[model samples]
Target: MLNIPLIGLKADQFRHPLDLEATNTLKQLPGLDLMVRQLLGQLGEQFFMLENLASSVQVGENQLPHLHQLLVEACKTLDLEVPQLYVRQHPMPNAYTFAMRGKQPFVVMHTSLIDLLTDEEVKAVIGHELGHLKCEHGVYLTLANLIVLAAGQISPLGTVLAQGLQAQMLEWLRCAEFTCDRAALLATQDPRVVASVLMKLAGGSPTLAPKLNVDAFLAQARAYDDLSSSELGQMLKQAQTAQLSHPVPVLRAREIDRWASSKDYESLLARSGSVCYDGETKTKGGWRNW
Candidate 1:
């Protein structure tokens, strides 16, 4: 598939309004920037980097070159510098990234996630993680992960503080996910590819992924939206997601579906230059490949 490289693409160009608003809200909170960058930044980066180096296989031209290609291509599409990629052995299908300003950034994909997704879908997952980097979301996201990991060790008063911080961080995290999903869409240039990944994450295993239907899953997302029409349903929905880090899969899928057809999406693509082709004939539209 051919993709246009969104040269000089800015996060605000495709950032979800909710993400923007929530981020602004987070910025207003006292001392978060200092706590995240000065307090947790270096320690978190070192910890994750060391762990990956010890326990995970890094993807590069000489190691897992196919996955390396996907990462490089996705970065190119998003106008991002390629970050280190690692595949770790794990039962759960998941991928995450860690980055801090002035530090080497990296992404890790659980082996099971690669098993569950097609090559294209894997690229979309990579793109999703790259979204975090593109938005410079590393600082706060690192704090959020550190909080979850250290939750059981805090003192009572510290626990209260952690809880308060966690709640706000989780809300921002959820909204940030919406923006990342948009990044995934920008990288793939195909809504179905991004939505399929979410569907698979919702309820897919290796055995079930082939049988799962993207269109049906999107319809289910619509159904979920309809379910929130009533006041009670809306309250229930809010309660369900209040403590979650990512939005419910159906809601994420629904947001991607809506945004893909929006004039804004079209306009962004129309404005972007630089095309990447998969071993196809070069065209006048600035065809390039990684």
Candidate 2:
């Protein structure tokens, strides 16, 4: 299999505008980044490391070679360094990444996600998680997770801060997922493959995955766009997604579908051959400077 690498791929090339806007607003918050990194980043990293190490199966050449190959391929396709991959035995289909500026980063996938997706679909999931790293989302992401987990235990001032930041963080997180979905498309070079993964996640199981129809799911995505065109429908849509960390699957499917057909995606593919690999590696080691 000939792999056409997206050499020199940068997150900005595909980052959703909403993600950029939300991230810019979040960064304007005075000392919020420093405070979160100083107060909770390292501790959160340790907590997740311990949790995954105790319960998840780590992927390597010696174990789950096929999935490991998918990880490697996705990393190369996106021009990113490979992070550790762990498969946890959970019935729900989900995956997430954890990374820090100067600490080792990793992605965890629920075992059920693997069971529900084919090798190509699984590659899309891996690519999506790698997107989080490529964009350096880990710092604030960890802080968001920590805030949600420890909101009650925080001091009154801290609670107020968390309350204010949580909505913004959640909004950013949702937009970030859109950017990652584009990453998945870049890695697979197949929009339907990415859309199928979303469709499956919306409602898929090991038994039903094979029977599902990607075309129908995509049509449904379009239908959703039509339904949400009215003012009342738009408000309902906002209410449906305001509290969620990821955009609804149909919305994601529609977004990817539009991007896949846009001139931007076409231009990107045409330019892929000209962009040579820079041979830079993304690895974290020193904690003192962080």
Candidate 3:
């Protein structure tokens, strides 16, 4: 294990622009951290307890060795410290990253999602989850999911608190997800791989997964982007994103599409030279200047 300190990567190195802006916006909200800490004690417990968690396949050398290898490879690429992985048996093709302020952190991937993607695509998803940990997103994401879960399972007062907290968490998460998508992009280096993962998640199964077209799906994403270019369109854009926990999938794809071509994404790779790229760090793009 490379013991190099990765904390120096900083927000500028890999965090998505929207995630950066939303995080700043969220910090301005009153008592944000207090609300987060207060709520995490309750919310954090479910992630660890057997009764609260649904079925999950924990990975190690003994189980899912292929996935274990992918996790190790992606972690090596980004210089992120590896966290434990849990593959939950869920029909939904979804995955999530978990972390607290500092105590416990891990990533969860749905079995269905694993079944839907290729090995490379799967690693991209792991990289996406790792991006959250890299950026310290586990705190807000935990609190947000908890607020929504609490609202549904508890009393009226809980509903009010959950509504307020969930809205904020959703707002933050939507952007954070995009940031992590870039992490996936960097890991896969194939925009099609990233886009296909989203498309499959939108609608896919073990049977239909093989036929999904990455190019056609990317076109769909580009078409979706065309919807927000006008004055009324811009208003709808604001309304559209204001309440969602994730950017609509197509929007996310388009964002990744845009970012994959941007100087920011290129610079990070040029400097970091991924695990597949080189051994000695060159500090390209003046990364050392940061």
Top model by lDDT, which number? 1
Candidate 2 lDDT score relative to the true structure: 0.83
Q: What is the TM-score of each candidate against the true structure?
A: 0.85, 0.85, 0.77
Q: lDDT per prediction?
A: 0.85, 0.83, 0.73
lDDT of 3 by residue, 55-124 (tens): 6778878889988888877776656667788888778788887666444567888878899988988988
The better candidate by TM-score, 1 or 3, is 1
The regions of model 3 sitting more than 4 angstroms off are: 1-8, 25-54, 142-168, 237-241, 273-290
Better structure of 1 and 3 per lDDT: 1
Flag clash pairs in model 1: none
- Tell me the number of clashing residue pairs for each predicted model: 0, 0, 0
Question: Hey, what RMSD does candidate 3 come out at?
Answer: 6.3
Ranking by TM-score: 1, 2, 3
**Which structure is stronger by lDDT: 2 or 3?**
2
Worst 10 residues of 3 by lDDT: 281-290
